[model samples]
Target: MTDAALSPLRGLAKLRKAKTRRFSSFDRTGGNDDRLHIEPGETVVIAEHAGAGIITHIWSTLACESESFLRKIVLRAWWDGEAEPSIETPIGDFFGMGHAQTRNYASLPMQASPEDGKAFNCYFPMPFASHMKFTITNEAEHDLLFYYYVDLELHETLDEDMGRFHAQYRQDRPHAPSEEGRTNEQVLFGSENVDGKENYTILNATGHGHYVGVLFSVYSRRRSAVWDWYGEGDDMIFIDGEAGISVPDTIRKPDPRIGPKAKLIADRAESVPGANDAWPPTLHGTGTEDYFNTAWCPTQTYSGPYHGIIAAGGPNWTEPVTLYRWHIEDPVIFHKSIRVTIEHGHANGRSDDISSVAFWYQSEPHQSFDRLPGVAERVPTFRAPYRNWSAVVNKTRS
Candidate 1:
């Protein structure tokens, strides 16, 4: 083999050897532990923790350097307590890539230097709470420094308890001919049905991704289904506005292709196969069988305040399903009962034979509607009301 091929093998071996002995000390208190030290000139710091793993809130500064000149400054973490570390590269499915690695960097000063350069902060959730390591490397030669902090405490999030998530289609009647796609389904639930006393939080999503489906809408009996919570179809933690962007129209699924269209577009943009020299290049939908083309559609509200599970893909061979987790963030303020209506078919009046579905939410608050004030019957609303939505519009959205 040539030197280039052999070079990679040698590099891999070195990385493997350096994998062990990553972290200096494991401190329980959230205080400075000088044992975790690095040479001022050194670019990277390797940290290791057993069982607890390593979760870090990292900040990077480009001292005396322009971001363009700063080649590669990244956060690398290894899963197995042994194999060579892996940098949390941008989102891609090349080998070991999953959730998009997010960054929060400070604004760049017109004149960049050590006294005042640019900085970026990012949060990392390791693969597991097992043996882990963290390293930050600066490929740039300029004197750059990174501000690092570690969080030993696992940030607790409100537990999601979706009570009585039941789905009963227009009763699969006994001794009746089964319908192909028109079994006319009703995936319903109530927040009060949940078991635990702990309240829930609401998570609304929108936007595009693999296996994304149409009719990604939410509804409650209280307000009109005029507004839908949008998402980018990925787990992006947000504090305000819509969690994800809504696609105005759902693209029809074309014939499946062999490779990902998004990848193909990316290659072209680079000028090798086809490259578009855009900072954020255009992403072509993989209208192929492997990916879905549903993009930019409005999201349905979880009705009052309900928790919902936005999931996709499973062992079963059917259209993907998303289960709604209710009363998650706050009390699902209900004038009446709450039910989430979903349809696998096209929202523009097209139809399909949905395969499987599931739902769960707590209903503890409404042990008896008679006791709660103003608790009444509410219905589903839709801009273009169809099926269950149409039936509930007049009685609800007014």
Candidate 2:
């Protein structure tokens, strides 16, 4: 829509080969009847299940490669009821949910023994009545082998306290002038109580930690609210016991260097749940990098901060491409089901572009899920998947 550079592909249905079967109710007592299959370089998934409450299980695997950078792979599913699902286990720590060592990033793919592979199980529980679906894709850029294991297998467990925890409170990166003015402080964790009241208390123990920012998200079973709804930028969660929720007194100061031409947008803003930094704060700079990804060069010329343009060159190369598809299923209420697929393509950095002939569908929206990119608002009434942005690489011809 905006042109191949910003959003390369539009209205391209990469999700081919549709299939489905009726659900006969989950057997929480034990056993699973749900299964899915994927061929090399293919995408597959269960779109969505509609209603008040439902459960889903998913499994996936990536085969070994001779010269590839993949060792082990695990699927990241959305937390059923919240914005920030759970803290991601640091690459090497292996302390959070989602099994698989960060080393798996290297080791799994080195298994050239033909039998080398990767896989995992994901369990989802819906608090309210809702339809659900499980999905997966083979994104290895090479041939991959995978299988799906799913079905509503209900059971009671003493370990229930351990699965799918939500966030209560989080600390974020100190924005802008503050970074240069103050000593760093550790962020505390937060969570909501049973009465639906949100609460966050700082974890003041001194230790080494990374401070990008923190997002405070709340999850609920009712469709009255979906996940990650940002009223402004990010909802501002206050600093505990700090004056005016202010920074340490030693760090606060006014810059006398304010020039005559400077402008103020808003005195202060709040942080949203699952956002990158803490709330009621200023960012390090103008947050301009979020707009332009210096990581990739743009071929086409454009002069607006909000516009995304891409470019590439090369004789026998697959030019960078973007894919698109829409959900044919109805609004995803609590229990209704639906399917979504991703398209693919091969571009020669010029005129020759071979679009994807494949697509994958799934019920749970992916973290990498994104709104079909463009300003046209082509499809209304649909909640776009909020996916992580990818680097726009332009291939140079040899």
Candidate 3:
């Protein structure tokens, strides 16, 4: 790691043999224009490079009339001539803001700067050996005006062990609602879950790599319930585990030998069917709030180098809540495949809109992502339980 407090002379000496290049959206015709105009449904190639290089920095600012434009514009990046993009996500969510809203926040690999968080920056080192291609697609109705800069450090030779950067976005609007007539209390304390099949999936990747981090956002919809907290779910990550593991119908019984250190344990053996004795969670977190580096229900917004709760929602948790966690100091390494998932609520009970972006580096060619939902489906919607004040007043009077 390059120490930031080194002497100026030492810094200069270290850079004497380094070669780097930058690709920007500045006017190519030597004019004053420094932005690109992207029409509706248009795709623009922002950066294309051949040979070995590491994209060290990315900065972008966009202008659009639609409030949902941030979620409409899609960004995709391909490395090493792969047909499938290694990075594919909405521009805003890719930078940390979700639900088409922006706010100033900072993280080690990504950040949204001041002035209402219009400036999006990323410092993830995306190294490509043969070629790298990045493009932005405008999926909104209105045209988009954008300015971007992709700074790259071109190395004469790249290290053989360098991994390619990858990111994938996924969203489940109102994760399949809990079974009808199932109350929150029952879901929380009565219901048991051994296999994580019903959990909201953050990432299901097959590769040999380390997960750097993830950005998760949720828009609450349940209102009838007195309690509006949305993060009671536990985080379960299976690393390099066997495939086609049969899920039990009932929760599994906890292993007596594992001791209490095991964060996630099978509640009952009869619940999980065909689960082998060796099946155990690789990394388990206490709760969703705990996984994001927060305790209890977070009500205030905060940002840091590795984790942050960018948006904490409004009164009654009605608004969207966004959180990010970067495993820079302690990355989750996986040799074969990894499945990262978290419950929507305790035991997959709550029905709320959830979306996430997973960032990691791995050897390509990676599994291609499924087609993204169309613009109509991608748009966010809010639903609250109906309230009748008159009825309450009448009942109280009677």
- Using TM-score as the measure, the top candidate is 3
Residue 106 miss distance in model 1 (angstroms): 11
Best by lDDT: 3
Q: Give the total clashing residue pairs for model 3.
A: 8
* Local accuracy of candidate 2 as per-residue lDDT tens digits, 1-398: 22233421442444323232333323445667333334444555434444333344333333335123121221222344434322221111111111111111111111111122234323323222233343344334455444334444332221222222111122111121212332211000011111101212111111111111111111111111112111111111222211124343353343334212222323333244322133222211111112122222223322222222211211111222111111112211111211111111000001111111111122332223222112122111222322321212122111
When 1 and 2 are scored with lDDT, the better candidate is 1
Tell me the number of clashing residue pairs for each predicted model.
Answer: 57, 65, 8
Model 2 RMSD in Å is: 21.4
lDDT (tens digit, per residue) of candidate 3 on 1-398: 46467664676656534467888889989998899999998998999988888898999999998768988999999988888899999999999789988999988789999888989999998998889999999998888999999998876767788888989999995454455675445544335456777888788777678889999999886753344578888888877653333455465564334222223554433223323112446676678989999987889999999999989986656778999999888988877677788988876777889999999888876767867777787788766533654564455457
Measured over all alpha carbons after superposition, the RMSD of each candidate to the real structure, in angstroms, is: 24.8, 21.4, 6.4
**Candidate 3 lDDT (Cα, 0 to 1):** 0.80
Better of 1 and 3 by lDDT: 3
lDDT of each: 0.26, 0.23, 0.80
What is the Cα-based lDDT of residue 223 in candidate 2?
Answer: 17
TM-score each candidate.
0.26, 0.27, 0.84
Residue 111 lDDT in candidate 1:
12
